[model samples]
Target: MTPTSLELSTLGHRIRHQRVSHGLTLDELGERVGVAGSQLSLIENGKREPKLSLLQAIAAETGVQVTDLLSTEPPNRRAALEIELERAQHGSVFRQLGIAPVKVTKSMTDETIESLLGLHRELQRREREAIATPEEARRANTELRLKMRDVDNYLGDIEKLAEKQLKSAGHVSGALTHRTVSIMAEQLGFELIYVSDLPHSARSVTDLENGRIYLPPASIPGGHGLRSMALQAMAHRLLGHQRPTDYADFLQQRLEINYFAAACLMPETASVAFLAQAKKDRNLAVEDFRDAFGTTHESAGMRLTNLATRHLDIPLHFLRVDGSGAITRVYENDGLPLPMDVTGAVDGQIACRKWSARSAFDEQNRTTEHYQYTDTPAGTFWCSTQTGTTAEGEFSITVGVPFDDAKWFRGRETQKRATSTCPDESCCRRPSTDLAERWTGKAWPSARVHMQMFSPLPRGVFPGVDDNEVYEFLDRHM
Candidate 1:
């Protein structure tokens, strides 16, 4: 490109000054800017009007701006970039000189900008190659597994994250979905395999066709049901390539799906048979039950909790409560409908009331409404359950065990505050007796266990559940 006489001279002079200021020898500047030292000298001396584009090239190479080359006011547009490059160059000089290059600054000169752009492109290229490489893929898988393990460690953290997300949107992040979960899983190393069958033989399976992973759903008997839908939703979350964001939606889906998964792990028929055999001798103990089924305590409790639903005589839900009296997990077996969010209410405090059972069938049926004080080797624990429902007709049944039981899963000192003891010295429950330890190693039936825990409807919290109204709302869209 041609240059105006003034612009050329202006550009040449800027280029010369920038080159010298940046501490670049003529040969170094020439090599960097794609111009020979002799040619550059001629241009600097105003013997020739270099191509306008050449001025851009020199500006870029020297970390100066094109406007700087063409302007006469002070340093021009390129001066800032040149100054930055000079600082960087000066730092390198200091480093070579055995001095600390402590106060370094960044430059945005043409050459530096070009170098940055080139570096970005190069990094992108390398990333593409890394993704395609088997070794890199394996490394990615290892990293993903490590992350998943960490995720398992902070399930409480996950619950908190979910709760925060739910309170924000009444759902998780919209971007969190099955696809994202699957992608994350693959990156973490576990393969996601999707299947269409209730109680699928495998929760996850490898897909040889595409050499990818699959997380299949537990099938429904007839291949249709809300439960199936929930399972599929969870599959999308857990096995798919997306991380789901809707905490409430995710919980609704995950619990329903995994309830079936845990159910299918030891199918209902088998569980019933085993429980029947155990009942013949005695109520199944926790360790014996876990050993017989080779399952976690929570898993075992869930299976047992499912019992009350099928048999009315055993109307109960089992939960592991923390010192703060928060129910971390709930398992339902005896009752068709149990109170929902039982976990949320008793989450971080001791339930110091007798177990109160409520039902959708009878809102005021109070069974075992009195707390029985008990003592045991471990300590005293107040345990109870009450039934209530949100205005939406979502039921919640809650039961609490001692916070010390948490040690079964985690080896840690039991916090006294969880047993209803006050944190402050002036509090009433101070020096409170250990309710759980008071009754430890006892063979009390569910009803006879001594602790004060109950669930009643939250005064103002209501969830809506009117199928007809829901249908009507949908009809409006139709």
Candidate 2:
């Protein structure tokens, strides 16, 4: 096989080392090997590849095997350091910094090279830590969402795995029962153990050695929350996940496990069948799907994004916005105009106040879903939003489709309509002319800054998880 650049560099170092050790000058070695001294210098400096015949001559003259001259191992510690420095200088990070490459010479001490390598390593560590920042995390999330949108957010392998597991548990199903969830866990060699004391940062913890899945004793009403947590824990094992090495890895693993859990909770075969029938009846609604599967409105809405485009040929969008109008989660393939930052990230950006997701928070009768037809710059889209509360705060879950596709949904005839000029400063970001004149320069309101804006992601083998707390909890349980 052709050697890599680094391997060839090491080979050159080995050849040079062997030649020097044998007390041969470059000119003498070049004459012995039937090559010019200039060419031999180039080979020794790793700038040229030597022929096998020339290598054999050098190996014979130097009293070493041909393999010795071709060995990838650096001949000495200094040579290894030099190779490392060269490799680091050639790296993208170093190149992006626009710094000139440091040239190593015989006069440069080994200590100086070690110091430079240490700085390079530190730079790499800092760069990795910077990726944990919220802006960087959002950028990564945005990219992942676009990729999911391209594939209609479907994972056939994961869907099949959920189906096989459900089949193994004898779940033919309306709503997946708690007992069935336990049976699935047991089949995977795990026992469901409910406990009062779980780590504050963790939802569920799995003891691989003891085959125990520890869960919170008190689950949310209707048991859907408990089932989801249990399924997510089992999914880590099912998906063969390793400890995340970085923020992006952590985000990916989190998405995969959640997808696995949703797939199990709302089995693909059953969900598609139910949706196909609903579309046939022209009664497609997120609440009906939620009730049918016994899942949260947000879960059902997201699950629809997974199936709607691929199975029903209907593109759509999903959104979860906090009461303050900031988007918490979003996915779109229907060309809805959602707010975004310069990085193309929608997370934490404020949704247009005129959109149903934000307006639903003000509805007097929030017991039912709010439906609206919004005319955006892109097109007119119909959305159904349901408002709910959690420990964190009030939020809205919405599922929407283009105006053309709204005919297949239940709330298509709703007379409520709105017009949004979003992404424009005048839309919702700016106050009315009179109000702006009245409040401008007179208001010095203190902004409520979220801690996440300034802080990096939690540091650990698992981000945001306290290892010591988990270990203590596990010890107490044992």
Candidate 3:
């Protein structure tokens, strides 16, 4: 990697930390420094560089002087070597010298180094455009999320369309019932099937011409994943989405479909009213709301974010993390800064062990709720999380609000706090010096697949379904 690119990540990380430390949202900081909030967001994410004047203003406002922002020590031997290899890939000098650069991060486990090297090779050739690695995909997605800043992460048009459709389906103004879901499907000319042998490539599928939808058996072990999958299939037909041209549009489209599916499952009017009542009762636990709506924890958590940002005006963030500690999905609307990797947003990157989502993996029961406070360079955020295990793997669903806003929710009472400065050296870059002195080449030997970090999240063509399988199934149906 070029030093400039590396500097971008480092600079963004520090400035974001400083901004959050000052308890200033991007909008507030932008107002203070006279830059657009969207531009500030990109600068904070390391995707954009600030002008000299803007940099001066940022230094004055955030107290992170220019030198500190620009200064990033060269990467450790491992990362430095990787960069040198990338730089020499086409260099005539390296070609003459035969200076083969081995792909590895000396500090990380061998497996991770391999996975990253694999990703680097995959994207090393093609010209960059939206889709390359999971990180690039997330960067594109984050940019889309940032665009919604003006609308507070609420796509009002999509939400309004969903409500109007729900009303026409006779769910005019109440909680959506499974019976009502069945009714809506029939009204849309779809026949729903609960199948025991549906291929594993998808959670659900639809045969539009045949007017049939397929779902896994209800007895399947795991979170209520099938519910959302089935609804998403229904949504594809209802929303009339054209084929997406690229991953960014694909991701953006799925988010809209998810909004539609959630509206159908939780129905905005009643869900909002119920949440309002729950807020009054100081019982905003997501589990209770999931139970109340008979939805899965993931769906419940997503709906909570929607309600918080769009309806309640509560400003919140949501995280869906794998048991392995990778952030599978993130929705950040609350102004708290999220740390991103050199590749992109936190997606597919390992979360700090100190994060609530990471801790949720340790819960005894697969479904018990976890509540905790996480203190980051940004600010403290109170979070409620729960685990859900499926055939795919166990993952955590977490919803958090900034510390200042936590008082309105029930989980604010958590005394446990985790300190984190992620994507930073102190977080996980090196072995603990004291612990290392004792073990020092004695017992640290393990290598699991951090492969999730390098894999692309297959979305768009079908949310959870593999795109190839979707095409095959549709072909067979026709």
1 or 3, greater by lDDT? 3
* TM-scores for every candidate against the unseen true structure: 0.28, 0.76, 0.64
Question: By summed lDDT, which 10 consecutive residues of candidate 2 come out lowest?
Answer: 125-134
**Model 2, residue 261: displacement in angstroms?**
0.8
Q: Can you give the lDDT of residue 195 in candidate 3?
A: 69
Separate clash counts for every candidate: 91, 0, 0
Which TM-score value belongs to model 2? 0.76
Can you tell me which runs of candidate 2 are displaced by over 4 Å? Answer: 1-131, 218-220
Give the per-residue lDDT of model 3 (tens digit) for 301-339: 888877777777688888888877878888787755566
Give every collision pair in model 3. none
Model 3: residues with Cα > 4 Å off, grouped in runs? 1-136, 148-150, 172-175, 196-199, 217-227, 363-367, 441-446, 451-478
**Which candidate do you rate higher for lDDT, 1 or 2?**
2
Leading candidate by lDDT: 2
TM-score computed on alpha carbons, candidate 1 = 0.28
Residue-level lDDT tens digits of model 1 in 48-134? 877777878888877867877777542554544433333343443334546443321234346655464454455444333322233
